[model samples]
Target: MIREPTKKKETSVTGCIRCGTCCKKGGPAFHLEDKPLIESGTILAKHLFTIRKGEPAYDNLKGCLLPSATDIIKIKSQKSARTCIFYDEESSRCKIYHKRPVECKALKCWDTREIEAIYDRNRLTRQDLMGDINGLWDLIEDHQERCAYETVLTLVDEIKASKTDPLLEKKALYIIQYDLQIRSSVIKKGNVDSHMIDFLFGRTIFDTLKSLGMNIRRKNGKHLFTTTIPSDPQPT
Candidate 1:
């Protein structure tokens, strides 16, 4: 029998140990360039989740945590671990290897220049996915514009401006819980997937408020919003 030659593996960047650490760390952030994979059914909307603008996320360029200024679409991770959903531990391979997102394809552990170039670029927004269909997109936009974070911020600001008001605390609590329910209702309506709801809303009301330095306390086993650092307080 004649022997056949085995072809060598091709790698664009060096120092790939194939340990899958990057995949374990976090799923790849998707971009507009990745629409082809979705169109081809290699990746689906159900497989993705949104990280909304104004949420705390790692900024690789600055090497610090900052609010994401734009919406980001990312692959969901396995429930058991932070690894990419497509990652198979038993085989130590990507299930969608041939049609992986651009981020996965461009990643190079050693050089990483290609990946970094696309990391902080503009992301696909809900509107980006909108075609002629107005129903879901309209709902998404309405919910986003009316999200509780802004209302909470306004309430907090008003309270700060008038420190003499004693009723502000009660008002804040009412608004917080009300906003939470609003989100719940939208989710229950199912016009948009729950995961999609999360991304479009940015961080939840609790998280966004916390990031803004609002003091949270548990009262009767219910989270109560308390004081927040004044935007500008005159030094006593």
Candidate 2:
């Protein structure tokens, strides 16, 4: 009869402790239900960015990187970090907690069933918000067409196949140049807020290419491309 004293039962975490872990990782993607928040000015467009259709992005739920099927409008991170812009580091709380996005409300870190169920449902797109706006929407549409990931990826594949096609390289470079030029023109000529560039045109081609393992640099006023082996192959 060498029975020891009974051990204390461990308490399970059933609610968000506001540890700021989720906020630190990144902000939630906006959904249709969160449209009111943006429309009502609870969430501003300047605070957001878009992961445009066909862009390669990390899928948290699926735990892999893949091309987005549609626009995934999300809150921008603070500065150079992944921390949500609304996250107040000192207090470990969301500044807009009372008006958080649908995904933020649905997310339960302890039991992710709620989040995964609605992760990709009814995602809000830039068109839904600004389709009726004159000139701006047209600009965005043009940018999407000229700087599409589909065309870029195709050029990348062709470059890999030929390994020395200067013409293919030139086409890719032109697309990158157009992408940069449009963002610059929008800010300087169109008088659009520079902060809204990411939301309008998604990320720049430089970032997109780098994420896909291609590096570009300027030498003697000309851009040079260097390819590196991607650690993860494109998800099937």
Model 2, 1-236: lDDT tens per residue? 00111122244868778888778777889889999999999888799899899887777666666788889999988888888899999988899999999888877667767777888799999999999998989989998898888998887777767766779878988988888898999899989899989888888887776656555787786677765434433332
Deviation from truth (RMSD, Å), model 2: 8.0
Score each candidate by Cα lDDT.
0.64, 0.80
Instruction: Note the residue pairs that clash in candidate 2.
Output: none
Find the candidate with the highest TM-score and give its number. 2
Could you tell me the lDDT of residue 171 within candidate 1?
72
Candidate 2 ranges beyond 4 A from true positions: 1-11, 226-236
Question: Which lDDT tens digits does candidate 1 get at residues 94-210?
Answer: 999888878787777766677767766756665677544576667566655655345556766776677535577677766556556656776787555766555445446665555
Supply the global lDDT for candidate 1. 0.64
Superposed on all Cα atoms, model 1 deviates from the true structure by an RMSD in Å of 9.4
How well does model 2 score by local distance difference test? 0.80
